[model samples]
Structure formats: structure tokens, C-alpha cells
Target: MNKPFSDKLRAVEPYTPGEQSKNNDIIKLNANENPYPPSPKVIEAIKGFEAEKLCLYPSSSAYALTEALAQYHGLDVNQVFVGNGSDEVIALSYLAFFNSDKPIFFPDITYSFYPVWCRLFNVPYETKSVDKNFIINPKDYYSANGGVILPNPNAPTGISEGRGFIEDILDHNRDVIVIIDEAYVDFGGYSAIELINKYDNLIVVQTFSKSRSLAGMRIGAAFGSAELISLLKAVKNCYNSYPIDSVAIAAGVASVEDDAYFKNTINKVIRTRERFSQELKGLGFTVFPSHSNFVFASKPDVNAKSLFEAAKKENIYIRYFDLPRIDNFLRITIGTDEQMDIFLNFIKRYLSSLSGC
Candidate 1:
């Protein structure tokens, strides 16, 4: 009796985050975390934060930060909902929008958190398959349902479905909520924030974890019509009233103000990705067209599993998924130019030893 978990949970496959190691010498490129540090202004803001404020309860509304987010996105404060991270915002979405009778629909290959949310909340859900190239066809999500959520540049795949594809879904699915998880949009995809004014059904969730380099602070946000934001706010109030803490709020406000930081960082990542993809092609690997900060690569000549093991031996680690259709591919995050240079040299030497290479 002590060992048995909830029946719903038994069916759920929990998300496996990338490996974080205490070994400092390893060149880690598994998760799509930003390779750079936070903006200088963000560091200054956090360092200047009042120490005595820690004893006080943070503002429940996070009004100042919400307004900063609103000003940045050209939205009103009521249209923005700040949370601990994009994960919390997603959890609230399920509670506020989903019912047991209706199912949450998403691309079969998407952010792994989608299915976990449904299982945790006891919400029914179904997966819709992506196209052969791992691109999401908009028509697959047109069915009448409880709700839907998919990342713009979907995780692991690093492919994006543009604003028009999302708008097409909004035109028909106006009754239920639609969540566009823009966790990686800062680098590749155009934002759907403009559609929020026209479509009350749409919700666009963003995170500072990727672009702003604030993964440790856990700052995430969502944008929707005032009516929908109110529901998320309600659920959040009941769960954790102070999800946005004092330090995080201070850091978040600074991140939005420093627009040049993202522009520079994203531009660098894009340049590195272009060169990296070209190099991979020369190495006989098929690198998927990517807009995000990582590349999903596959080569028929080499075994993907063996390559992953070999990299670990070289003290370098990248992501390898055991899922259907993509088990042979490696999702490699774009690291610094120096890091990539090291990776490339080591990999080339290893490739020469392989029978195919």
C-alpha cells in the first residue's frame, strides 16, 4: 500500500531534465540554457536589492514587474500574469482551462511537460503527430477540445511554426483556450503577442530562463486577454500567493528593460548555429533546420547511441532522447565559439576512427 502511487500518475512518464554534474571539467551542452551570463544591468539590480526586504512578504500582484512586462510587450498590466517559472504558469493553465471531460491537445512531439500536466491534474489529453520533418501542421489542433498548448520553436526539435499558423488555430478554436509556449521565441520565432489583442482565446507564455539568462531565478510569464489572465491569477493566488519573490521581481524588471542584451546574445547564437550546422553537414550528419539555440542532428552512417557514449568518454555531454522517430538524433545546444571548436576537433578525431567516417 505504501508503494502504490495514484493510478493516474502510474501512466504518466515524468519529464527527465538534462544531466547537471559537479565535475567542472565537462563541456556540458545538453539543456538549451543560455551559454552567457545575465545582462550587466540585471546583475547590478540584484546586487542593489535591499537586504531588509527579505523579511517582508512580496507583493502578491507583482504589479511593478507585471507593468514592466506589459510595457515591454505593449500590453496592459491586466493582460500579463507573472509566475515562478513557465512551469507554474503551465500548471495554472491546466487548472483554470481544462475539465475532465475535454482533452488537452498538443503535438505528439513537443515540450515533455504537456502530458505531465494533464496527468497531474487528471485532465484528459491526446497527442497529434507532427509532419515528417517534425514541423507541426496547424490543422491537427483544429478539433474541438478542452484546450491546447505547444511551443513556438518546439523543444528538442528546434523547429518553429510561425505566427500565421497559430492565428489560423485561433480563428476556429475561439471557445477554448490556446497556449503558445514561446520559451525559445526570443531567438527564432516571431511573437504571437500582437494576436492577443484580437483573439481573447489566446495565451502566450514566455520565460526569462532562455533569453534573459535567469534560469536559476525561475522567472516566467504569460500574456492573454484580461479575462483569461484573471483566471490564472485566481489559481495562482490559491496555490502560492508569492510565486514571484522580491529578488526575482527585481531581476525580471531589469531584464525586460535591457533589450540590447537579448538582441546581442540571440544574434551570436544564430551565427554560431549557422556555422555549426554547415560543419555538421560536412561531417555527414543531417542537421535539422533550427531557429532555436540548439541543433537536432542525425547521420545514417553512425550509431547515435554509440556517439553519445563516446562523447561522455571525451568529457563532453549532449542530449540523447530514446523516444520514437528521434532515437537516433542528438539534440546539441549551441555553446560558445571556443567550446564548439573544442567539440568539433574532438568529434572529428573520433569520426576518423569510425568505420563509416
Candidate 2:
């Protein structure tokens, strides 16, 4: 005999993260992870941490880290909500604001996790298709909806929408919550955090996993009106009171304080991404205009699944989505200049072999 599974469990298909291989030689450009390390301040903060504090519970509110983020973003402390990661913040937002008979709306090609969250929470959602170019038209979002959620500089496409476009969505959907998942904002996407005060229903969620080089810390945050933050906090309290631990809080505060390291690393990633995009085009790939840390591209002559296998054989990793509209494209993270150079060289050799040159 087996235990009965819940109806939700039967219906739910969990989100799948990008692969993490054990081989140390692999040049990992699959997941959109920051190639740089976290700020020295983060390491120093961890080194100086009080080991005795492990015996006590961490601050359930994550108050100190919240204050640091608040100062950086020019918001009141009450307007910030911290969670285990931005993914958690996103999941909590669904529970706090998106329960409705009217379906929430997101782009058809976007961060894959959005649909998973909707299914787990039992929130009805409709997937609105982006244009054939993979560009999201703001007009398509102007409709009756329970809520709106989208990632600017959309994943698997790496295209960022302008601030004016986001404002238009807010203008049309004034009655319901609009969640902007800004996980890649620091790369080149314009953050809607500036629009939060004007639109009470807008919630901008971000993560330290990308630009801050702190994916291991698992820190994510959200910004909105105080009332909106309060609702998320209430839901969080009901679930996990200490979503952020002491070490993570310390590292997050340190990462925020080191402005120089943050800008330097982000600038390097942006520069490398542009150069990589051009190199891909030279190799006969159609590289999309990307504002994120990765490029979504494909070649007319070569299949992406074939390239994925070829790259893996050479111990270089990139991502292939094997799904609708994007099956032929690969979302390759912009690693260090040296790493990308090696990847491009491998591509050249692969192309030469294919063409018998």
C-alpha cells in the first residue's frame, strides 16, 4: 500500500534548473550565473562572523540586510521584502496577491518557473505569446487579468523591454497586481523599481544570484509599496519565519555596501556579452539583441542539439531548451573573456569539421 498523494501534487510538474556537472574542467556557460566572485567584503564579513551565534535563531525579519537594500534602492525599510531567494519571493508573491478566478498573465516564452508557481498555488494563468521576434508587445498585456508577471530582459531570449513599455502595462492594469521579475536587471535591463511608488500594484523582484555573485548565498528581495511588502511578509511568516539565515544576511549587506566591486564585475560581464554576441554572428549564428548576461542565438547551418553535444564533448557547457519556439536556440552565459575565447575556438573547429574545410 502507498500513501495518498494530494490533488495538487498529481497535477504539478516541478521546475527544472540548469545542469551542474561535477567535472572541474567544464567551462560553465549554461546557467546565467555571474562568472565573477562576490565582493571581498562578503568574504571578510563571513570570516569575521560570530560562530557562537549559531546557537541562537537568526533575525526572523532580516532587518539589517533589508535596511542596506533599502538605502541602495532609495526606499523605506518597510517597502522591502527579503526571502531565501528571488524564486521564493516570486512564489510567495503568488500566494499573497494572485489568488483569483481571473487568470494571471505572463509571456509564452519566459522564465520557465512562472508556470510552475501558478500550478502549485492553483492560480489560473494565461500565457500570452510574444511576437515572432521574441519581443513582448506591451499592448498584448492590456486586458482583464487577475495579475501580471514577466521577466524584463526575458530568459531564453535575453531581450529587455523599455521602462516606457512597462509603464504602459501599469497604466492599463491598474486594478490588479503587476509583478516584474527583474532577476537580470543589473546586466542591462531597466529596473521598474523606479515605478513602484507610482503604481501601488507593482512589485519588482530581484536576486543577488546574478550580478552580486552570491548564488550560493541564496538571497533574493522584492520592492513595492509598504502594504504590498506587508502582505508578502505576512505570507512568509506563515511559511518560514527565518527564510534568510545569519550568514546570508551578513554577506548580502556586505555585497550591497561594496559598490565598486559590484559595478566593476557587472561592466565586465556586459562588455564580454557584446563581444561574444558579435563573435557568434561571425560564426553564422543569429544572435538576438541581448541586454542580459547571456545571449540567445542559433545558427542556420547547424542544429542546436548537435552543437550542445559538441560543446559538452569539449568540456564547454551551454544551454539548449528543447521546447517550442526556442528549440533551435542556445542560451549561453557570457563567461570571462578567456573562457568565451576558448568556446569560440571550439565552435570554429566544429564548423570546419561540418563543412569539410
Candidate 3:
């Protein structure tokens, strides 16, 4: 019998998101989501959203949210592009810019989605391995390639490089598009938004999910030169003219306008992350220095897979990559203080029991 699926579809492996549990009682920390609720203004905006607007198509350009983001980042309105989420934005970007014969480059241990997009788009790509310390050597990116895309405060590892590091990459690859995925920048990483005007080849993508507490809303935006933004919009319109809905636009605008709430929430996550890292260290786990909402760690004597399974039994969800080099480590999101304490206490008891065994 003949298969019906397309050859490309059959060959590609989709990206796997963190496990999501529907149980309300579970201390869910697998996904790097904000522990707090969205701003009160966002709540009111969603509540006050006109139900009648659902009958009408949202702005194809997502003008209001785009305008809010442009103003927030001090960029011209034409320099902004909004999408369903940062993932969509980055995926569309891959389609728009990574079509050259030369392969694009990203860190080997960075966000898993980079390779997925490359395959889906039929874009050739190469991975530059980060050193033993999980630090992406800026020099590795300085090579002949179609383009470069990497996360600031990279995923799983959560290690962030400074503006100087990013600038060095831009300085080398001025001919091709360079994307800085800043999904976790608000946590503690320095943003590349300010460098947009200075580097026309650069595009900085950010999401409202992690920091603005709008993951459910699915609002993401990209900042770049007007020329690059135009290309992204062209690709987006080809795929989905109205990627963001009316309700999301209103919520996103409110979330951006409430700067005070955004800052406060980020500070809370930072404090909790620092304390949790120290606590994990005290427990003899090697915790990677994180600038994002999650920490990557491993205890030398314990099997990470075993610990992950044990945590699942207790209704505590965390992330564990079975991929090589990272299988021994666990990626734990920084939840609220009370939740962290609960997890810490469970870990202490679990280790004590292991010692007895």
C-alpha cells in the first residue's frame, strides 16, 4: 500500500514541548511559565474585550500591539512585526531569511526548535557545539554561513552572553540576517533591541509568555530595521494574515503598558531563581548559572532520569532531556517561593532515602 503523507512530512521530526499536566494539584514547573498572574490591566483588557469583535477579522498587521511594542522599544512602527508567538515569529523568519545555499548556524545545545524549523523549511544548517562549560563561544559563529540564530540566555542551560558577545557576531555576519531569540531576556539577560538600529541584519524576537504572563495569549513581536520587518511581514502574510487575534492584541497592549507590573514580576522570578540555585548547590548539585526563569542542574551521584521519574510520581513536573550530553541534567523552572520550598523539601527527603538505600 502507498503512503498518503508528503515525503517532507514523513521525514521531519516535530519539536517536543515540555509536558503539560491537567491536574490542578500538581506543582507544574516543566514549562518555563511565569508563576504570577498577568497585570491587572491585562485582566481588565481581556474582560472588557468586545465580544462583537470576534465577528470581525483582527488587524492583519496587529497594529495596536505592534505600536505598543514599537513605542516600548523606541522603534518606528514599521520596524515591528507581531505573530502568534515567538516560535511562529522565528519559524516565519527561518522561512523568510534562511533560504540561502549556505547553511545557517546555531549553538549545538541551544533551543531545540532551531533545528526543527530548519528541517521544516528545507534550510541547510550546522550546529556549533558550546564548550564543556555550555558557554557558546562567539568565535564559533564567526564563519561563512547563510545566517545565525541563537537564544540569549540559551534554553536548558540558561546561560546568557552580554551585548559585546552579540555585537561581535553581528560585526562578523553583517551580510546575512542574524536573529537573537530573546524569549528569556527579561529575566536577567541584556536585550539586543537597543542594537537593532545599529545592525540592519539583526532581528530580536521576544514573547509575552514568560515575563508578561501572557503565554495563553500567544503574543510575540520582533524588532529590526524597517527593511527586515517588511520581509518578515511578507512571509507572515503569506502564511496567516491575522496571526494574532483581537483579544490577544488588547491583552498584549495592556501588558506592555503596565511596565511597573512587568518589572516587579521579573524581579520576583530572579530572586526565587537565585535562592533556588544556591539551595540546589547546597544539596551538592552542579547548577548552571542561569539568566532565565529556569535552572539546569545535576548531582554527580544521582541519575537524573531516576530523579525525574521520582518527581513525576509525586506530581511534581520538571524537564529532563534524554539527548546526549544533557541526559544527566534536569531543567527546573523557578516557581513561586512556596512551590520551590515544597520541591526542595521533597528533594531533601528523596536524597536521604537514597543514602539509606
Candidate 4:
């Protein structure tokens, strides 16, 4: 039975996504999902889609969605590549650009998927440790390598690096590809899309999942030079040409077009995040300054794992990683004001009961 599996499959450790509970009663703040619903236009677009179109294959090129994103981001259509999800885009990126004898590099505490993709693609890679403060210094990534990939407003910690810092890394490693995963940029982080034109080595990946409230649609995209985009397209076609379906494409276009709704929802999440952060501090938790929709925090008195279990018992879900360097922190997504109030109240009671207050 073991002999039937591919060599790569045998060695691979799959990435674990945040827990998605089946209980509707649970306030899901584990995954950094947008608390609000998608734009009404996205719903209309999906509903208006012709059932007859399902009989035929979707456009392999995803032209309509690609063109819409290009227009939204002020890029040429050829510079944009659409995918089923940012995860797929990331996987394809590893296939397309990171194939080399030299090892690629990413922050040790960054997206867990980066190393997983490297293994799947047989791409050699190295991890650079982020500072004790959980900030990624651009200077650490100045070494030569196959390529580089890291999340901006990095996941779990939600720390964001500036454009100037990114430029410094690019300046040093001019010959290698630097992939910036901007999954949470719309919430509060600055996007690397602005630096794309100035640096040929830059590739910016973003998704509708977090900001546009379209995670169910599974729409994601990448922005790079035409040559790099073409390479990704080629790899994508080789794997699965019709990665994005008609329904998703239509909804994605509407999501991009409705900029006002996008802004309103993002602002709401940001406000909620800031409020949540302050409240956590008042409760004796050390909260990281998060530019993304989630906050990484720790309570000195209570164990994060214990609190995670305690929250789950009360129909609330938050992320707790048992991995080293971050085992103590809880990555809590910013839900609606009502939801956060419920969560905060629960934590307060839990801590009070512990101290017999």
C-alpha cells in the first residue's frame, strides 16, 4: 500500500487550515474571514449566472475576471493571473518560479503553507527567523536564494512590513523572485502592488476571501510582469486549465467593481479589530499591533491552549497554535461588534473565575 504513493506524497505534511465548525451557534473567529457578507452585486452576479453555462467548460483564461482585476489594480490584463484560490495561486507560484538548486527563503513564523508548497514542489528552501518582537526585518532576507515568499500583514501575528522595507529586500536579491502574499492587505496593510511596476522580481498575490467577503467563491489572483504571469498561466494550464469557474468569475468581477461596499466592510472590520485589541489589553492580554483583521495575543496568567478550549465550550472559536515561538499566542479574528463583545465577556468571566474574583 505504501509503494503506491508518490515519493512527494510520502514525504509531505499537509497544511492545517483553521477549524471550520459545523455548529452555526459558534462565533467563528478562528479563520481570518470577513465577518460581513459579500457585496450585494456579487450575490446578484452569482444568482444571475445562467445554469446552461454549467454544461460547457469555463474560460481557462478567466478573461473577464482577469480584465476586471487588471482594471481595478491598474495593470495590463497580461500581468494578472486568476486562480481557484490564493492557495492555488501560491502552489502554482512554487511550481512556476521557485524551481532551482538554491534554497528559497521565508520568515520562520510566517504562513505555514510556504514550506508545505516547497516540499510538494521539491523546491529547496530555508527559513529566516523573525525578530523576538515578531517583526520581519528586510535585512535578514538580503541573501541570494532561489526565490522568496512571505505574507504581508503576516498571518497569525498580523504584522505588516512597509513598501520601503520590501524594496530593500528586492534591491539586495534582484535576481530572485519575491512573492508577497497580501491576503489581509485590504483590511489595514499596505499592498505591494504599488512596487510591482518598479521591480520586475516582484509578484503580489491577493484574494477576495478576506476583504471582499468572497471566501466561499474561492477567488484569488496574482500581479506580476507579463512574463511571470505567463509562466504561472502555463503551469496552471498544465495542472488544471479551468481552475476558476463561471460563477466564481462573475462574482469576483462584481466584488471588484463594487469598491464602495468593499471599503465600508473593511473599515468596519478595522474598527472592530482596534476595539478588540484595546479590550484584550484591559483584560491583561498582550496584543500585537495588527494591521490585518486578526490579533495575536497572550495572557500572562492563563495558558492560550486552555483559553482556546474554554472559548470553544462557550460556542466561540479562536486559533491557538502549539508551534514553538508562538505557542502562547491566540490568533483571534475580528468579528462584528456584537460577536467581539460576547467573546470579550466570556474571557473576562473565565479569568475572574480563575482568580475567584
Candidate 5:
């Protein structure tokens, strides 16, 4: 523990991830993970793996996975890049695009890791504020120097901006490499994969974690013109040559092959999200229109922190943040209808108890 670290890391506040509690049989809704397990094809893929393959190294470029994923998304192999996770993909973007002179820019309340990545690389960055309603206006980003990166259905709020609006920003800021992190896009948001043909500066990052139910497997990807992919390859070649392992490549290839499973899971999450939002609104909580798998809600009387604590006492787990505007809001991941019913039952009990108190 006495090893001296770089001075750049001294003041770095790394990201605080969602809790992974095993204390009780709670209706867990904290992280925005899929309520269901991954597709059977993914498991089957792993089951069919050869035992002797472990003796050899995984393909440095993960060629099989890259080809499968590229075909699944209708893109060329040269235009796609895969990594350990979209987090790493974003990290590479900073390495490829960011400079201390031209500050990178992202929404003030976006994926907290954006700033963390900047600090990790000693890259200066600026934060553009989202409006009072928590919507990202593309025009607000025109002034930033280095580039911009943001989630579509922005985290902790689940609000999404339209494709036309994003294209407008691309129109004006043609020089900057705009990275769209679409970790939760399948739930409802539009995919910028469609626009990559037109905008060479756009880099869309996606993950198998959220929608594909592979958080433990760690496979994320990015797509853009071949030029950008080559820059990412240069960085990837210098950093760690083998960012993906054998098992992950197999699971990732199978995950995309079973398109039916992805569609079914997305439908279920969307349905449950709507049901949860209506129920919360009926109970006097203000629910935002969520384009992601989670709903952002806040009641007038009970604060987010109190609600989080009360739910914990009842063996129900949801997410609550103490940051700026989101301090009062709770981010509840959409689970199965049965699982959510358990959570709602506990919440109803909490409200009843408060009335009597």
C-alpha cells in the first residue's frame, strides 16, 4: 500500500458504483440491470467451449466476435471496435481525442465516469449544464473545445434527446468527435448507429451489460468510420493487446446471434417500466418519462434518501443518489412484473405506515 502513485491520481475521486447487497431477499431494483437472465444461447455457447482452448490466448482482436457483432449491426469489421466494456471504449476515446489544451465537455450530471476518465488521463474538461427539466440541449455544447460525450437516455434521470437534435449538434460541431454512450438505448431510445454513415466524427458506444444481461462477462463496443476505428486500434494496441477473453467473446457472439431474446427482454422491461411509473404517479410521486429501463421518481413529502432507507428496512432495494439535482430523485430499475409487485407492496406499506405516524 506504500507504493507511490502518480500525482495526477492523488485527488481523483473514482466512481461510486451501485450497491451489491446480499443482506436480505429484497426486491432488488438498484442497478439498471436486466431483470431476467441472459439468453440460453449465451449459456449454450459457453457449454460448447473446448477445454483445451484455455491453453491458448484469445484472438488479440477478438475477430470472431467482432465479425459477428458487425454483421448483427450491419456494419463493416473495420468500422467496429470492441473492448472490455463501454467504459474502456470511452476511455480509449479520451486517449484518442482529448488533449489538455482543448477541454472535453459533457453534461454536468451525466455518467459520473466521464469526469473520472478525464482526471485519469490528466485531460482538462468542462461540464455543460442540463436544463431545469434535465433535458440535454445539443446547442449548449457548441462552445466546448475538445469534444463532447453523453448518454442518450441520460443516467439517473432516463430522459432521452431525439436523433434530429443530435444530428443538429453534429452539423455545427463537425470538427469535434461526439461520443454517444447508448448503454440503455434498446429500451426506447434511437440508435445513432444509423447516422455513422453520414457523420464520421460520431462514435456510438454500447454495452452487452445492460440490455444483453452480461454485466459479469464485460463486453462493450463502439462503432464509427474506419478512420476513428484505426485511431482506437492504435491506442488499444499500445495499452492491453488482449482486452477481451475467450469466454466473453463466445458469450458476446451468441448474445447477438439470438436477436429474438434481445427483443423479448426489451419488450418486458419497457412494459414493466410503464407499469411502475403509473403506480408511482398514482401514489403521489412525480415520475419522469423514462426512455431507459429505469424510472426516475420523487415524492413531495418523502425525500429520496428517506425513501431509500425506508425501502431498505422493508427488504426492498432501489437506487438513491446524493448528488446535486438528483439528490431528491430515486432511480428504480425495472424488474419482472412479479418482482416489481413485491416492491410496490412494500412501498404501499411504507406509505400507509407514514400516514399513521
Candidate 6:
């Protein structure tokens, strides 16, 4: 029998997201979601939204959300492009700018979506290995390539590099598009949005999911020079004329306007993350210094898979990757202080049981 799918589709492997459990009783620290709720204004916006607007088509450009993001980042309206999420924005970017014969470059253990998008788009790519500590070396990215995309305060590891490091990479790759995925930058990492005006080829992509508590809303944007942003808009319009609906637009705009609440929630998560990392270290876990909302850690004597199973049995969910170089590691999102305390207690009891003490 002949297979219906094309060879390209057959060869491609998709990106697997973190497990989403339906049980309300479970402490889910797996997906790096903001444990906080959306801003009060967001709630107000949704409640006050006109139900009659559902029959009408939303703004094809997602103008309101794009304008809010532009104003938030101190960029012009032409310099911002909005999408359903940062993932869509990035996938469109891969289509818009990464058509060169040369292979693109990204860190080996960075966001797993980079390679998936490459295969999906048929874009040739190469992975540059991060150092033993899982830190990206700017020198490795200096080589000639199609383009560059990396998550600042990288996923899984949650380690971040500063502006100077990004500048070094940007200074070298002037000809190719450099996308700085800042989905987790609101937690602690410095943003490349500030440098967008300086580099024509740079595009800084961000999501409202992690920091704005709008993962359900699915709003994301990219900031770049008007020329690059226009290209992304072209690609986006070709695929989905109205990626963001009116409700999401209202919610995203409200989330951006409430600066105080955003900062307050971010600070709370940062404090919790720091305290959690310290607690993990005290438990003999080798914890990576994190700038994102999560910490990546490993304990030499404990099996990560076994620990993950143990936590799952207790209704505590964290991320465990069964991939190379990080098979022993666990990526735990920073939940509320109370939640962290509960998880810490669970860890303590689990370790105690292991020793029969």
C-alpha cells in the first residue's frame, strides 16, 4: 500500500509541549506558566467586551495589540507585528527571512522548537553546542550561517546571557536575521528590544503567555525595523488574515497597559525562583542559575525520571526531558511561595524515604 503523506512530512518530527493535566488538585509547575492571574484591567476588558462583535471580523492587522506593544516597547506601529503567539510569529519569521542556502545556527540545547520549524519549513540548519555549563558561546555563532534564533534566558536550562553577548553575535551577523526570543525575559533577563533600532536585521519576539498571564489568550509580537516587520506582516497576512481575535486584542492591550501589576507579579516570581533555586541547591541538586521563570537542576545520586514519577504520583508536576545531555535534569517552574514550600516539603520527604532516615 502506498503512503499518502509526503516524504518531507514523514521525515519531520514535531515539537512536544509540556504535559497539561486536567486535575485542579495537581500542582502544575511544568509549562512555565505564570502562576498569577491576568491584570485586573484584562478581566474588566473581557467582561466589558461586546458579545455582538463576535459576528464581525477582527482587525486583520491586529492593530490595537500591535500599537499597544509598540508603545510598550517604544517602537513605531510599523515596527511591531502581532500574531496568535510567539510560536506563530517565529514560524512566519522562518518563512519570511530564512531562505538562504546557508544553514541557520542555534544552541544545541536551547528551545527545541527551532529545529522543528526548520524541518517544517525545509530550512537547512546547524546546532552550535553550548558550553559544559549550558551557556551559549557568542564566538560559535560568529561563523557564516543562514540566520540566528535563540531564546534569551534559554528554555529548560533557564540560563541567560547579557546584552554584551548579544551585541557580539549581532555585530558579527549583520547580513542575516537575528531573532531574540524573549518569552521568558520578563522574569529576569535583559531584552534585545532596546537594540532593535540599532540593528536592521534584528527581530525581538515576545509572548504575553509567561509574564502577562495570557497563555490562554495566545498573544505574541515581534519588534524590528519597519522593513523586517513589514516582511513578517506579509507572510502572516498570506497565511491568516486575522490571527488575533477581538477578545484577545482587548486582553493583550489591557495586560500591556497595567504596568504596575505586571512588574509586581514579575518581582514575586523572581523572588520565588531565587529562593527555590537556593532550596534545590541545599538538597544536593546541581541547579543552574536561572533568569527565566523556571530552574533546571539535577541530582547526581537521584534519577530524574524516577523523581518525576514520584512527584507525579503526589500530584506535583515538573518538566523532565529524556533527551541527550539533559536526561538527568529537571526543569521546575516557579509557582507561588506556598506551592514551592509544598514541593520542597515533598522533595525532603522523598529524599528521606530514599535514605530510610
Candidate 4 achieves a global lDDT of 0.91
Give all candidate RMSDs, comma-separated: 1.9, 1.4, 1.3, 1.4, 1.8, 1.3
TM-score result, candidate 6: 0.98
lDDT of 1 by residue, 200-286 (tens): 989999999987889999989999999999989999988999998999999999888999986898899889989999999998999
Per-residue CA lDDT of model 5 for 1-357, tens digit only, reads 345675534666798888888676777888888889999999999899886988988998899998997898899998999999999988988999776488887899888888888888888888988988888877787774788788997987899878897898788778889899999899999889999999999999999999999988989999999999999989999999999999999999999999999899999899999988999999999998999989989997987798799988877789998898889989999999998888888888888888995
**What does candidate 2's lDDT look like per residue over 111-220, in tens digits?**
99999988888899999999989988888888899999989879988899888999999999999999999999899889999998899999999999999999999999
Per residue, candidate 6 scores C-alpha lDDT tens digits across 1-357 of 356665544566889999988899999999999999999999999999999989999999988888888888788999999999999999999999999999999999989999999998899999999888998999999989999998998988998989999999999999999999999999889999989999999999999999999999998899999999999999988999899999999999999999999999999999999999999999999999899999999999999999999999999999999999999999999999999999999999999999999
Which pairs of residues collide in model 2? none
Candidate 6: stretches off by over 4 Å: 1-11
Distance from true location, Cα of 52 in model 5, Å = 1.6
The TM-scores of all predictions, comma-separated, are 0.95, 0.98, 0.98, 0.97, 0.96, 0.98
Taking the tens digit of each residue's C-alpha lDDT, what string does model 3 give over 88-168?
A: 999999988888999999989989999998888889999999989899988998889999998998998999999999999
Give me candidate 1's TM-score against the actual structure: 0.95
lDDT, candidates in the order shown:
0.88, 0.93, 0.93, 0.91, 0.88, 0.93
Candidate 4 has its poorest 10 consecutive residues by lDDT at 1-10
Which digits, one per residue and each the tens of the lDDT, describe model 4 over residues 106-178?
9899889888888878899999999899988777887779998989989889989787888888898899999
Q: What C-alpha root-mean-square deviation, in Å, does candidate 1 show against the real structure?
A: 1.9
User: Higher lDDT: candidate 5 or 6?
Assistant: 6
